[model samples]
Target: MLEQTGLKVSSRYIAQIKKKCGLDVGENFNLPKSKNARQPQCTPEKKEA
Candidate 1:
């Protein structure tokens, strides 16, 4: 959109603007909500230990 307006604003500047306007800038809602979503795979030996 900035390209269309011929404006050369940095990503940091855009994030600041979005924050000031109270807009959802970088939030990702599609991620899993489960607590084990990012748990690493446990080996049988590690589990037994």
Candidate 2:
């Protein structure tokens, strides 16, 4: 599927797969850290009062 999308199976994306899908199975596999994901961060205080 990824190859069809012209996307190389890089380590970063592999980590994401391990995280979102919980499919880690290799020595070099690394799960994407939920807290440190490259997306935006919204702490409770920032989102509310």
TM-score per candidate? 0.41, 0.30
TM-score of 2: 0.30
**Tens-place lDDT digits, model 1, residues 6-44:** 455555456556675688889655767886776334333
Scored by lDDT, model 2 comes in at: 0.49
lDDT of 2 by residue, 4-33 (tens): 654435554544455656776466455576
**Model 1 segments more than 4 A misplaced:** 27-49
lDDT of each: 0.55, 0.49
What's the TM for model 1?
0.41
lDDT: which candidate is best? 1
Number of colliding residue pairs in each model = 0, 0
